[model samples]
Target: MVMSRRKTKVNALLSVLISLGILIFINVLNQSFFKRFDLTSDQRHSLRDASVEIVEELEDPVFVRVYLEGEFPADFKRLRNAVKQILDELRAYAGENIQYEFINPSASNDPVKKKEMYTKLSESGLTYTNLTIRTKDGVEEKILFPGALITYRNKEIPLQLLKSTNRVPSPEMMQNSINNLEYNLLSAIHQVTQTRKKKIAWIGGHGEITGLDAYDMVEHLAERYTIFDVNINEKLNALIGYDLIIIAGPKEAISEKDKFIIDQFIMKGGAAMFLVDGLQADMDSLQSQNNMMALASNHNLWDMLFNYGVRLKRDVLMDAACAMIPINVGKFGDQANLKMFPWYFHPTLITTKNHPISANVNPVFTQFLSSLDTVGNDKDIKKTILLETSPLTLRRMAPARINLNTVSIDPGFEKNSIGKTPVAVLLEGKFKSLYANRLTPNIEQDTLIAFQEKALLDTRIMVVGDGEITKNYSNRQTGTVYPLGYDKFLRKIVYGNKDFLANAVDYLLNDERLIKIRAKEIEVRKLNDRKILAKESEIQLANLALPIIIVGVFVFIILIIKRRKFS
Candidate 1:
């Protein structure tokens, strides 16, 4: 027995020593090599190869300042944890070059200090969310900054962490925001690290909004592109070097010469966004006088668009699913009563889901929008309707009068408006020139004005039936314009105009692959609330008794085996 015990001791010591040595060796190897196994069905934990490459090729460090740290609800906590996990994954590839820090801006109790910090963050382009939490005694309000500021080289960019489309927050919205975490982080990094920016021109010879009025639009595009105003001025080579051009809300007519220049540009593989105003309605006149006439604007681009694929009709669209405008209904001193009425003329647009450009976007708000009808039968041209009105939509053709006071009295409005009307479309493939047999620029002196009847390369164009969707409202008091798609009076962002416009520009600029990445959908699984409530008692009993029962059985089995062996 003593000899057997000695052998057992010796064997135990050898096993311990061997295990220690193996652990030391693994530690040494771990310093130089790394590997991670992701067992997720959708590879949610795995970064895309493109993202890994972007990080691995970094010559300098990318610093991310995450502002999601604070005492918040369980949902926000999950979001914060996910952000950390993603950052760690990124750091595994880029090592210490991917640096980050978590900051809780609301940690400070001093009011002045908190305001100062918030002001600075806002100026730096970070946005915050306000939340109200229920406590045992009462409800308390909280402010959460669910965003980040990323800096690489000398460029800095702000990333919004929440994907909110409505005024109220929902669990689905939070999940969608979480699903986009990787893309948002990597895209921001990619934007700052790009050595050369793509050039975009906002064509301006036809009275498009410019300067401060168009600052919001320009600022967003200038983040990833070099944006400048280009007045074609009938110059043959005016749009030669531009990757994309935007003709946003032009009021004046485009001359045939200028149109020919644009057509030739498209022939040579160019892309453009045409924000056309098919029906002109004076909103201010209606607001002041409570009455106005809706008429068609003669910008003279209808024929060109028809030839391409879409017909921007000369009618105003109405929908039951629309926005509300406040009106003073009571007499002058009767407490100044303000009532809200559904404004049918301002239809809220529905975004198409199957297309990447409009996927997962919220309803777009429009003023005096026209319906679209696809006209071309060319097999070479592929047309996709990106935006449309709800099934309850009707068209009021030109020569109809619009009276704001008649909204409450229109009994047949809902019955008449009952069909999905197309408002925006995307045209792709080789385009046949509208000026195929028509005369081109007087090339008597300018040899550069060459005409190709058909597109030499596949091109894309996005046409929206309403121009006001791209225009932002200016503050009369401060002269500062709200961001495009924001409703100042409603004090809410009820539209996805900015998102749609950006996606449209991206699609036109030939970033379909990248846009597809943005359109990736992750299914969020959650326990059904009603089922959980119904089975709450059963679940609690199982949780309390099942583990104890298993443990008791296990102990009884072990005791019996030991007793049998001893016997």
Candidate 2:
């Protein structure tokens, strides 16, 4: 009996040691490698390869402070959970390099402290949401910021978690913001950690947009690029070093010398964005004088553009689906009465879903827009329409007259606007030089014009018929500079112009990592409310009893095992 007892004790001791040894081995293996298994079919919990790469390559720790804690609503809570999960996934790959904290800006009980927190976030470029919560007592209001600040290597970058449409939030919009959680976080990290800034040449000295009118976009672009004001100035190598030239609505003509310079730049694989208005007309003129003529503005590069595979129509594109402008309908008791009317000249360009550049983008609004036609059929080039007018459209050529009375061509007169035209296009391929035969010695940078008839490298060019897409408006009298896509008349109606420009830039630069994340459609599985309501009692009973049953079964199994061992 003593020998039997000694044997049992030895076996038990071995079992304990073996269990501890297995645990230690597991701990060592976990330390050596990190892995996460996501079994969901949609891979909702998984990070993209691009995101993992960014985190894994982190030279320093990336700390994100998310101001989404202490949330009241279910949607906000879901968003908060998603942010944490993404950070956790990143941390799993990056180990200690990825870190995050959920902060509540409104956590302080003191009103002064909370106010200061909000102010700080606002100044740091983070926006807050005005949330209305319906409670048992009554309706309550709350201010919450669906944004975060990512700090990497001592630089803090603001990331907006929710993309505000300047309108009421729809259920789908909330889910979209949730779906893009990974992108928002990693983009901020990538932005701050990036050492080299790509140079962007802002074409100027031809009356292109500047100052507050372009400040918002310029600021946003500067976050991702180093912007320089470049004047072609009839130089052979004026735009030579720039990766991309942003030609934001040059009011004056582009000299052939400068045009040739731009052409050569493209021949060498440089990208250019043309926000040109074929007609020289703006609302500022019509608003003051009540009438103006949209004459054909000469930019003097028509042949060059045609050769490159697009013809910017020298006309005004008017659409029935358009924006509203305050117009003087009639007089009201000694006050010049102003009433809101649909301005068809300012059409909201519909976004095309087929292309990543414009996929899921909101309708872009433009003024005095022109149509584009793909010409020359360059076998190497690919023309994808990014934005176009709705089928209910009317396009009138230059020498077109614009007057306040023209809102009379409102949505009611849809029959006249039965035509559709593409207002923006993305041209990509190896382009043939327009100056193949006309090349001279001075045209070449280092040597005599070594005119290559065909492209030595592939390139891309974005052609938008409306200059207004790149222009931001400011109330000169009040000095209030509105955002690039904010609607002046209707505050709620915001355009997708800024997003369109950002995506276009990314695509042109051949960097679509963030764009790919934005394009990801996360499927939200909604519960069937009717079925839930029908089986409410059963569901509640199951929920209340299932946990107890599970615990009882576990306890019973444990007791049986203990009894067997003792026996």
Candidate 3:
């Protein structure tokens, strides 16, 4: 009796310990224990790791307001769900500092007040769209817009609604846009909640694209930057206040005085982008001469680029994989050929293995391209080709005649015969100005600054062989705006040669952390049909006999053990 009592007591003590352990586990899970698991694929959680850092560093609450209404249209349901999923993930990852609210305007049918609020929002430059639906007997519509407005401190930033025409969003395009949003938002929150905006300058003059054309890029970056346009002729030291400067596609030659100003800007550690064209394009002549292409190479800025370790050759590059346009040649008739203009010679540029400037950018487009040569191996200057032509490319010298008939890829062209050609290049490091020792040329005088003796600036510069690739040229005969290639207006707008140029600028400015966003891994899994079939047959046989086999083995083992014990 005493032994049995002692055994029972020991069993009771073990049971109590197990019960206490289970209770503690349940309590921990109810609090914060289960949150440690990263049960998300990379696709669904691109910013998961970064978000944790952001939350930990966050000192204040971020208020997010989303404007959505009852029962969305069938076409918009996918977008709505995607937005909700992203917001939920952000909230979870951001911890207690991220607060969200959903607002439905239709809930309150007061038109006067609703219109007043909408007008205020519209005046603030917030974009919204209406969704219309037609029933059997009547028509019903709802105003659906991006409902989230995030506020850090007293500053408010709105999140625009994302919609795609295709049922499924293009993974590449969607990822680019989302990555842009995450970076912009993080920077905004960081600044508004803490520091001031950084200043940047866009160099005017030399016939570059106006600030109006760059409004979208400017606005996207304005949340964390103060952007302004300055002409080098106006004030040279005016750029001193800015952290970066941008020199867009310049038509006219850059004067030595202006070049001195730019050199000084770089010397002060100000970053700049030089989107130079190798050949000068005359649209009027091309249109008047029946689209006869002419090459214009005489530019005063070639010396500067040469001194900076890049040579823009005076040749037009044509690739067999060109963009097509409808041309009425009057002989082959009005059919599409793999032409060079509307369909640009899109160089499948291989970006540097580890550089932010080329991250996530698809192939870039170039027309009337010039070859770039690296001159004088400067130890401080690092140059890499950001864009290049395929091996099946040929270069045509300028002042050569070109017509629609000369645009097609020759069937006899061989890849091994032609070598790989560089179309665009990225240069980073200290650069010596070409005018370092030379006297300032005769030009209108501004407050001239002395050029730096050593490399003035640690900067990033992108040189493109062609400029016409980014220009939007329309045919006078047809009112249609010709695209470099392909259909779909959004693709034309977002992924065009201009888009590539804009992406280059964004990368240079370092406004968007595009380099950090990982590319989607292509999962390629194939089934072995024969092996699978054999395995299926084996599994079926085992399922049928497993129970019987187990029972027989148990009986044999028991009988053998009993016989041994008796003997």
Clashing pairs in model 3, backbone N/Cα/C closer than 3 A? 66-147, 67-147, 266-457, 267-456, 323-343, 342-484, 343-484
lDDT of 2 by residue, 1-567 (tens): 999999999999999999999999999998888677889888888888878778888988988999999956887888888888888888889989988898989999999999999999999999889988889899999999989998888688899888766545666667878887887777778788988777899888888887778887888788778898888898777776789988887788888778878887888889989898889898878989989888987777678878999998889877878888887767999998998887888998778779888987778889899889999767899988888888888878889988887767444445666477888888999999888867555654446444456777888999999876888877889887778888767664378788789888878887687776666556778999999999999999999999999999999999999999999
- Tens digits of per-residue lDDT, candidate 1, 1-567, equal 999999999999999999999999999898868778889787778877767877998999999999989789998998899899989999999998899999999888999999998998999998778888999989998888889999998889898888675555687778878988887888788788888777888988787767666778888788778899999998988999888888877788899889888888887888988888887775898988889887787677898899998998888888887888888888667577778889888888777787888987778888888888999689999999888888888778897688987677773656786589888889999998878866635752345666788988898999988877778778767887777777877765667888788878877886554565566556567789998999999999999999999999999999999999999
What is candidate 1's local distance difference test score?
A: 0.83
Model 2 residue 292 lDDT score:
89
Candidate 3 lDDT by residue in tens digits, 1-567 = 999999999999999999999999999887774364445553554553554466567777888666764566644454455556556666676777877777765565799987876776666546666656678778876665644577887778665655233334454445444444454445445555655666777767778755444454555456556788788784666677777776656778777667777766776666776666666665346556755655656446687778777887776666655544444434435643422233333344444444555555555545556677777778888888776666667666776555544544343447432557876777788877655556544332333554465565477777777654454534446554443322332334333454455556555666444334322232324678888797998877889899899999999999999999998
- What C-alpha lDDT do the candidate models reach, one value each? 0.83, 0.83, 0.61
Of the pair 2 and 3, which is ahead by lDDT? 2
Off by over 4 Å in 3: 1-42, 46-55, 134-138, 163-194, 211-224, 282-284, 291-293, 331-354, 408-412, 415-417, 438-451, 468-499, 511-514, 518-567
Steric clashes per prediction: 0, 1, 7
Q: After superposition, how far is residue 54 of candidate 1 from its true place, in Å?
A: 5.0
TM for candidate 3 is 0.74
Give the local distance difference test score of model 2. 0.83
